[model samples]
Target: MKIETQCLHEGYEPGNGEPRALPIYQSTTFTYDSTEHIGKLFDLAAEGHMYSRISNPTVDCVERKIAALEGGVGALLTSSGQAATLIAVLNICSAGDHIIASSSIYGGTFNLLDVTLRRYGIECSFIDPENGDAAIEALFRANTKLVFGETIANPAITVFDIERFAKLAHRNGVPLVVDNTFATPVLCRPFEFGADIVIHSTTKYMDGHAVQIGGVIVDSGNFCWTAERFPGLTEPDSSYHGVAYTRDFGRAAYITKARVQLMRDLGASPTAMGAFLLNLGLETLPLRMERHCANAERIAAYLSTHQKVEFVKYPKLPGNAYYERAMKYLPLGASGVIAFSIRGGRERAVRFMDALTLASNVVHVADIRTCVLHPASATHRQMTDAQLEAAGITPGLIRLSVGLEHIDDILADIAQALEQA
Candidate 1:
């Protein structure tokens, strides 16, 4: 099936007389007549959900759908995108290990790597993605476990060179983990560009209605886990009856370890109802992404020509810094986000956001309803000046999330907001 058809039919197929829609399995525990069967589940020898904390019928379906969409061997759903990132790294990394990440990632994620993870004795080196391969290659330490980047950065709208970075990571014998939140699978699949792992904040574009907050990590099953680099996968896991993941699960080692090990301990599994709502959003993802791209292109063009706008940073715009790379990585659309600054600084930017009547001023992005946010004040506020600059956020920058609303109305609202500013 094509991607559009796969959106609706890939995850859950109705059996005879079953409901056409994916049914929500709300119960946390499944019944088994034999104690030996339950033992098999605890030992990782069974293929069933033993507890909701580890897996669920509804959530498993969504994970499978996303894995299929991303062309991954398997996936694991998490309570939020942060949890997914934490587990994605922790699944392969431990205390004293090192990580290499692009500086242009979401502020929250940057904090996770820079601040919180440092307390855990895991050091991370933030490299400029614009820096050439030689510069990036120099950041890799002997203990580096993985390289991380975002396909399309949040607020910055900078396009990451996925294939270039992937090759660099492969050269260092580390897998490339890409955050594909802004560019959903409908727009770009990082796995096809040599990413070994793909992650998404399902709270954003995937749940188009903004009804639920969720996330997922998809494993490409392409990286080799050497015992020297990833003992957790190649060596015996005493916590799981001495089960060596790569030896036992083969291509599924990464995701399987992520689920049974980190997820089991962290307990960040999504609720069954949350997964149900996410599936509803997934069913219409292809259609929604198409509309989002079309609307965003027009908005970026309009903002670029505006006198009050300092500059527009949407890859769809001609002559944009990331245009060529976007064309190579994201041919369908650049998703429904644009980053631009006002002529004045933060004060006028705030005024513009407040003046907007049609677009919402909220702490979210990629919703069906249009919204705007000032990065320096809201999302990226915790970052220092140097960190903010590294993320490409100016004091006057506004992150506009173009929605499915009619372009004329959206443009009219922006004009009025500019007038007020």
Candidate 2:
């Protein structure tokens, strides 16, 4: 099925008497008629739900929908965006393993890789996105298991060159893992450009109404797990009675291991309630994305013309460094996020955000309502001045998440706020 059809019909098929809408299977455990059948599930010899922590029917439906949308063999939903990132890496990496990641990602993700993961003996080297292919390839070591980056980085809004990153990763026999949270599948499908795995903070665009907090990891199923570097999947696992994930699961090796192993141990599975809400939000995603792009383009143009605006960093605008790349990867739209700097620095940036009436000042983005935030003050506050500059977050920069409101109204709100700034 095509993307539009898949969004509505791919995951769940209604039987003659079944509910048309995907129902929430809220039970924690599924009953089996025979102990032998239950044994097969626990041994990973069969495909069926044994426990909610390992898998849930309601969450499985949503995961299938997301996997279809992302052009992946399978997907796993997690309790939060952070959990998704952790699971995606942990599935393939272990202690003493290393990763090469772009520096222009979310503050939380940066902290995870730079600080938290380091404590677990998983090291990461941060590289600039503009470093080009040779520079990126230089970061990879013999123990580097994966290369990670974002499609459109949070706050920074720099569009990654997917093809370039993919080439570098594959050359080193590693898979490229991308955070598709900002771009979403509607704007760009990373798998088409050779991304082996795609991760998302469904809390943002997927749940456009801001009704749920969730995340997902979609396995493209194109990478080879038989490589000697990854023995975890190709080799036997004593925990699962000497089962090899790659030998049994085939294309689903990555996500299957993530679910039966990491999810079972860590228990970061999403609830049926969150999955239901996310599916509801997915229904209108295509339509909402169109309005969001239109509104953001208008607002970016408005801000670019304002005297108080020092600079605008939206890819849709002409002369922007990422305009051509955005046109190639996200031709339909370059997302609803826009980053701009105010002429009066941080003080005026705060005033401008506070002056907005219709666009609320919030710590959220990619919602149905227009919202604005100063990354230097709010999201990226943990970074020092040098760290902020390195991430392209200036002291006066403001991040605007344009919503599905009328473009004129959104622009008017920004114009009024700029006047006050």
Worst 10 residues of 1 by lDDT: 5-14
lDDT of 1 by residue, 1-421 (tens): 7889889998788899999999899988999989999999999998899999999998999899999999999999999999999999999988999999999999999999999999998999999999988899889888999999999999899999999999999999999999999999999999999999999999999998989999999999999989999999999999999999999999999999999999999999999999999999999999999999999999999999989999999998999998999999999999999999998899999999999999999999999999999999988999999999999999999999999999899999999999999
Provide the TM-score for each candidate, comma-separated: 0.99, 0.98
Q: lDDT for model 2, please.
A: 0.91
* Model 2: residues with Cα > 4 Å off, grouped in runs: none
Candidate 2 lDDT, 1-421, residue by residue in tens: 7676777887888899999999999899999899999999888878899999888999999999999999999999999899999999999888999999998999989989988999999999999899867777778898999999999999898999998899889989999999999889989999999999999999999998878889999999999875589999999989999989889889989889998999999999899999999999888888888888888888888888888899999999988899999999889888899999999799999999999999989889999999989998788888888878879999899999998888878888888888889
Itemize residue pairs with steric clashes in candidate 1: none
